[model samples]
Target: MITETRVKIDWDSLGFDVVKTKSMFKATCPIDGKWSEGSLVPYGTIQLSPAAGVLNYGQGVFEGTKAFRTVKGDVILFRPDRNAQRMAFSTKRLCIPEMDTEFFLDAVLKTVQDNIDYVPPYGKGSLYIRPIVWGTAPALGVRPVSEYTFMIFVSPVGPYFKGGVKPLNLKVSTQFHRAAAKGIGNAKAIGNYSASLFPLMKAKSEGFDEVIYLDAIDGKRVEELGSANLFIYKEGVIRTPALSGSILEGVTRNSVCRIASDILNIPVEETDVDITDVLKAEEVFCTGTAVVVTPVGKITYQGETTTINGNQMGSVTEKIRQTILAIQRGEMNDPFGWIFPVNQIFKR
Candidate 1:
């Protein structure tokens, strides 16, 4: 079994990589149509059939979110309910049984509590929660499985970028599309990422931090970064691509829109953003659960490059990042009732 004693490590040097914690939560369901009450188990691998549905057909979905250790020595989760809702949406599309919000939140909270000792210090990092559901039954045809597994694991991770909080150089991919216009792009399916691997690798090899995919149909409208949602600011307005059924609606992206409009009093718009608008924007950034908000220094498209905010982080971007981080870490008030204290769920 995984231990409660914290392992020794350089927390300051942590990256957005997996470092297994004490325990994980798991449950199973069979064709009989009943889900077992999940339990906390030691962190380890599980045996699967050679023809497991997930292995063969990629019938799986997952979520990424973080739990922070507050300055007051409390652990808190940020908008887990939204993650639960998104997971349900994904599973429904994949034809897998969806877990209710109560069960999903309970599993996440229990896993965090079981691995409490591994929760990084407030400033060092936060505990990253990954909840995945997969079809487990052996299958030979392209169909849903009769058996399924749901599990959640926790890890402590630092910033996604190696250098931390710096503007990233992005490359636009016209030769490839991350998702079709009427496909499962909006779902958190494992297959969606698998399709992006080659383009992302090519972008990295070309010295770009990430790749921004254009729409599959016209290949002119902006979609999103490989792992995050895109946003551009110009003339006191913040605009991001609308939910065109091809972009993953990011939790951080939603939070930024709300914070910008409600707190910062800045106008926010969701519409079809042309690539030219991105090239001329005063500032550009991407948001995700992992990379909360990262500025874009430069974007290259069709052998032409454009610099945003003189290749520096914009003031509005900085303010939005700070405000969200502050609310997450409990340094500022969360008027939206987004923060859920772990202590309230599980006694210390």
Candidate 2:
């Protein structure tokens, strides 16, 4: 096993970028065989044939979750089971071999434990875990490949957005649709993100932090951000875009809704969020595994920019963010049983 002392990292200056760790977990599934027993491998580049299905046909799916070094000097994962379930969903959707949830969770635990020392000290940052599966067999036809590889890697990262926790300025993109109504937008497929890169980069060039995409069918209802789910608050009620087979069901988004309803006693609704509603919203925010619960300060659509709650993080948004963070850091009681302690899992 590789030890962590071989690498030197400045944890204090960590950003939302990859800081290579000691090892990663890898497992392979043949075309007609089950997944192999995985093991830890050194973090490095992977080789793939030019005619690989994942390269030529875009057959791949990935998941993102974090491991936190809690205040009590123990490492934990927030709702890893949910991530495991999601990965299985994504794999099935992409025509890849379905991974057992237990196998997925076990792989994640082993990978994180091998790189445990890279998990920053409490309050510094988190170990970002990325689990990815791709078709590795070379193929010329537009079909599923003969082999698949599942790998999990970790990186120490800070906030997703620079200047940590500050409200974001977003642009409403009517010209670009994130995912089609019946497409793979619901899955965490690699293609879904590639489609957003152009729009996202354009939004950044326009002095916006991110882009908010609308539904592809009618283009009237708000779908989600480039990489996060959208939320808006009005009249003491919290609402997000409904999961209408076009939106990715985010783990953080679900957690936010649950926390708002159960802990904060705020009403949460998943329905069609129109552009008009977003304009009139008193509060706007986005959630994801990486972005977490971040406030939207301003929203611009069709030449008009609406400032949300005087361009600051709303009280409700702040409350929800704090509550989730507290629970994640083990500073508050986890009424939802979302926290998964790594040490406890290892003991078993």
Candidate 3:
């Protein structure tokens, strides 16, 4: 059993950077064996061979979720089951052994519980959970490896954007493609993120907060950002790009849609969103586990810039952000059964 030990830190000054916690959960499996019973281990680095399959062929997948210190003095996970399901899908796509959802959830629970002391206070921030799987065995060929490793780690992080909750300025990138059609873009593959780094860096250097990529098939429809899903509210309707086998299926995007339709009684649709629709949108925002619901103040494409909602966060955008935060922090009733109270289920 892992004992809970309090980790002292400057929670008030916490940012999105990784703050190491007490322990991490780890487990391993061979190509012909089942996953071993995982346990909490002291947080540290693991050795890997130079020719490891993950290092050579990029056979790794990762999932992100959050555990919040709620107003009710409880530590709860927000829709972690969805993350587990996505991880399984990603592993299958990468030709790795499919991860059982139960196994994934149990590992996350153990990791979070072991680091329960790092869960920030009710309003400071939430503990970010990252679950990753990779092919660990050394390999010189291009085929599947002989072994795999799955690890879960927790970090206490604040806002993703450094400058508080300000509206973002995004640039439409027609020069690069995030992921190709009929590719592993739908999976949370590590290679997909590696491909996005250059475009994101170039966008940042050009004075944009993020780069929004268009569909790989045709450069007409908007896809998503480097790390978040895009949404536009126009004519009282909310629309995001359809999951066209390229865009990542974001958990926060799904939550925002559900909250819009069920709680706020707003119309929501997932369809092919064109650049023209975004240029004329009443409100624009992006969603992810890290960036929650950050509004896009402006979008620039081909020397033309369009200011959204007069370069301010729209009322509807704020409504969605607040509503989701409320549910996560236990400030409001959870009608969708999303919050998983970990402290209640697993006592210290």
lDDT of 2 by residue, 33-112 (tens): 66659899999999999999999989999999999988898999999899889888899999898878888999999999
> Which residue pairs does candidate 1 place in steric collision?
none
User: Tens digits of per-residue lDDT for model 3 on 207-298?
Assistant: 99999999988799999999999999988899999999999999999999999999999999999999999999999999999999999999
TM-score of 2: 0.97
2 against 3, candidate with superior lDDT? 3
lDDT: which is higher, 1 or 3? 3
For residues 272-291, could you state the per-residue lDDT of candidate 1 as single tens digits? Answer: 99999999999999999999
**Backbone clashes, candidate 3:** 0
Where does candidate 1 stray beyond 4 Å?
1-5, 31-36, 345-348
Collision count for each candidate, in order: 0, 0, 0
Q: Which ten residues in a row have the lowest lDDT in candidate 1?
A: 1-10
Q: How much does each candidate deviate from the true structure in C-alpha RMSD?
A: 2.7, 2.5, 3.1
Which ranges in model 3 have alpha carbons more than 4 Å from their true place? 1-5, 344-348
Runs of candidate 2 with Cα error greater than 4 angstroms are: 1-7, 346-348
What's the lDDT for all of these models?
Answer: 0.91, 0.91, 0.92
RMSD of candidate 1 to the true fold? Answer: 2.7
